[model samples]
Target: MKKLVLTGAAGRLGSYLREPLSQMCDRLVSTDWTEDIGKLYPSETYVKADLGDLEAMEAVLDGADMVVHFGAIGDEAAWDKILHSNIIGAYNVWEAAARKGLRRVVYASSIHAVGMYPKTQRIDTEVPHRPDTYYGLAKCFAEDLGSLYWDKKGIESVHLRILSAAQVNNPRALGSWLSYDDLIHLVQQAITTPITGFCVIYGVSNNDRVTVDNHKAAFLGYRPKDNAEQCAEEVLAAADPADPHDPGQMCQGGPFASVEIGFSGTASMNIVQDKKEI
Candidate 1:
């Protein structure tokens, strides 16, 4: 491809994607609201832009072939913040993609979109939305937006309903973790796939205890290598007893499912802030 745009360049996951994505295109335009994302990889450049600014997004996406949209307020937050960053930001990405005539959008959707479902039920990508918070609701909106654009405007999109892409510190991560290497592989598949009209796939590794089924997305050929179960003995040994009745423990969304609307679910997870840097 001639050019690819990546939003949220400064984010933990986006940081990992920068170096790899740069190799796949002649030019990689990485955007975020941050002043700078420090160093850049070969063929990579940074752009300071807000996701809420449609005009700015249009400018950043100009001449780009595809966009990997990782931009958004990551955790549960106030309705106004979620509306501006996640919901409106998603619209700007799709709307700008449509206006720019981009080939496809590889979005970073979340399990929170279907977070209300019990972990016992191994749901698939087709399961109806049961968002756990304002953040999750925004993800649902983006997934639907992607579908609408595909059906009506002939735009292509791939919504990767990422479970948990952080450190395997907690027990839930044993089943829900998506290792960084697996995440890169998933995004690569989403980008290089030939004829994906509008797809939704779970972003999870080949965990023995995986809670979701990805058989429907077998077409994407995303074979995740890492398994969080490797750290299971250690994680489990250190873990406290889980309450069966707590939504945080029983539901797919974990903390988000149990927390109040505006609160942060990630606070309780003790996720290590380890971001890959180039």
Candidate 2:
């Protein structure tokens, strides 16, 4: 591809993806609400754009081949923020990608979209939506929007229902941890695949205790080599098992399920601040 556009370029996850994506195309346009992302990769250009502004998004995505959209509120927040960033931002991305004639949208969906489901269920992409918070509901909306555009128009989409892509320092990480390497591999697969109409794949690693299945998305050639088991002993030893009655523990959404709708669920967890650098 001659050009590719990536939103949320200032974020921790987007920061890591910039270089690798830069290597894949002639020009990698990385955009964020911020003026800069500290530094730039060799084949990258920075753009300060807001996802809520449909015209701004269309301008940035002009002449792009594919879009990797990780631009949104990363956690549970007030309804207004969720509505603007997650909901409206999503609509802007899909509509812009379709109107701009981009090949596909590699979206960052969340396990919270089905977070209310029991952890023991071992659900797959085929399950129904059960969002635990306003944030999760926004993901649900984006997933549905992706499907609608693919069905009505020809724009393709790949919704990655990410479990947890942070450093592994808690028990839930033992089952849901997705290393940065695996996250990159997942996105590479989502964009490079020859044909993908509208797919849903769990964003997880080869964790030994994983409860979600990615077998349906195997054709994408995403074979995660990293596992969270390496840090299992340390993580489990530092944290106590979740209470059976607590949705934060028993449900797939983990901390997200147990928190108040507008409150921060991850604030109480023992997640390590070990942001992996590229």
Which candidate leads in lDDT?
A: 1
lDDT for model 2: 0.90
Each model's backbone clash number: 0, 0
> Which residue pairs show backbone clashes in model 2?
none
- Candidate 1's displacement at residue 191, Å, is 0.4
lDDT of each: 0.96, 0.90
lDDT of 1: 0.96
Residue-level lDDT of model 1, residues 98-155, one tens digit each, is 9999999999999999999999999998999999999999999999999999999999
lDDT: worst 10-residue window of model 2:
269-278
Off by over 4 Å in 1: none
